[model samples]
Target: MRRSRAALMAVVLATTASGTAAVTADAAPASATRATACPTGWGSLAEARAAATTVPVRDVGTGRHACFDRLVVHVPGASAASLGHRVRYVDRLRQDGSGRTIAVGGGAVLEIRVAAPGYRPETGAPTYPGRAGRPLPGVDLTGYSAFRNTRYAGSFEGETQFGLGVRARLPFRVLVLDGRVVVDVAHSWGAAR
Candidate 1:
C-alpha cells in the first residue's frame, strides 16, 4: 500500500531520465495553474569528478504539465560520473565547442551546459550521435504550449551545451536526479496570465 523511498527515487529517476519532467509529489498543486516558483541562478558544477564526460546518449522530450512545461536531458549514467552541469537563461547562445552563434527561436534561451566530453577518449568519435547533426534532432514538441525549440549547440573540451527556446524567460527549475538531468520552464510567470 506504500512505496519505499528507494522505489520512489527510482521512479523519479526513470521518469526524468526518460525526458519526462513530471511534476513531483512535493510540487505545488496542479490546480493552482500558475507557473510553479522556480528560482533562477540554480546552476552548479559537479563536485566529485575532476572533469566532465560526454558519454551520455542524450534524448530530448517535453511535457505540458499542469503548472509548467518540461525539457529533459536523459543522460544515462551517474550524475557525478556523467558531467558537471550548469543551467542558466541566457541572452544569446554560442556553441561551447565552436564559439559560433546559433539561431534559436524563442524570446529567451535556457542554456544547459554539462562539463562532459562529447567524444570517446581514444577513438575521438562523438559520445552522442551529434557529430553529424549538431542538434541531435529527434524530439518532437509539436503542440507544446511553452517550449519553442531545442538546439544541440555543440560539445567540446569536456563540456556539452544545449539551448532551450521558450516562449519567454519564465521561472525554471533544474534537477540532477540519479541518471537524469531535468529542466522545467514555467508556462506563465504567474496565475494572472
Candidate 2:
C-alpha cells in the first residue's frame, strides 16, 4: 500500500508540472508584451510654463519619427530652464500683437507661444525670418505623418507665436531642452507599436 501511494503522488506531481509548463509555453512573456505596448502617458492637453528670457528664437524646424512628428524651436544661448512656453490647441491661430487670424492647413491647429522674441531685443534684427500671416520659413511639411502645415503668427512684446497644423488632435508632449523647445505629436491614439 505504501508503494502504491508513493507512485500515485509522483504521477500527480508530474502531471501538474507538465500542465504548468504547457500554460507557460502558450502565453507570451511579460517583457515581450510590454515591448509592443505604446506609450500613452502624454495627453492632448495644453502645456504651459512662464519663464521670461532675453534669448531670441533662432529658427523653427521639423522632423519625422516612427511614432511621432517633432517640432523644434531653436533658441540660441538660452538654457532649458530659462525659456517659457504656452502650447495649446486653438480654433484659429492669431497674431501676437494684431490678433489677426492666421490660416493653417490641417484637421487641427496648435498654437505655440514662446516667451522670447523672434528678433534681437537691442537691434530689432530678425532672428527668425518668419513673418505674420505667412508660412513659416524653412519648414516644409512634405511627407510627414502628423504635421501638415506651419504658419507664423508674429512675435511681439517679448513673445513669439506660431501655428502648427496636424492631421488630427492626437496625443502630444512638450520638452524644454538646452537651446530647444521641442513638441512631439503622436501619429495615432492607438498603439504605436
TM-score leader: 2
* Model 2 TM-score on a 0 to 1 scale: 0.80
Single out the weakest 10-residue window by summed lDDT for candidate 2. 19-28
lDDT for position 103 in model 1: 71
> Would you give me the overall lDDT of model 2?
0.80
lDDT tens digits, residue span 96-159, model 2: 6677888999999999999998999999998998888889898878878889999988889999
What is the clash count for each candidate, in the order shown?
5, 0
Clashes in candidate 2: how many?
A: 0
Global lDDT of each candidate: 0.63, 0.80
- Which predicted model would earn the best lDDT? 2
TM-score of each: 0.69, 0.80
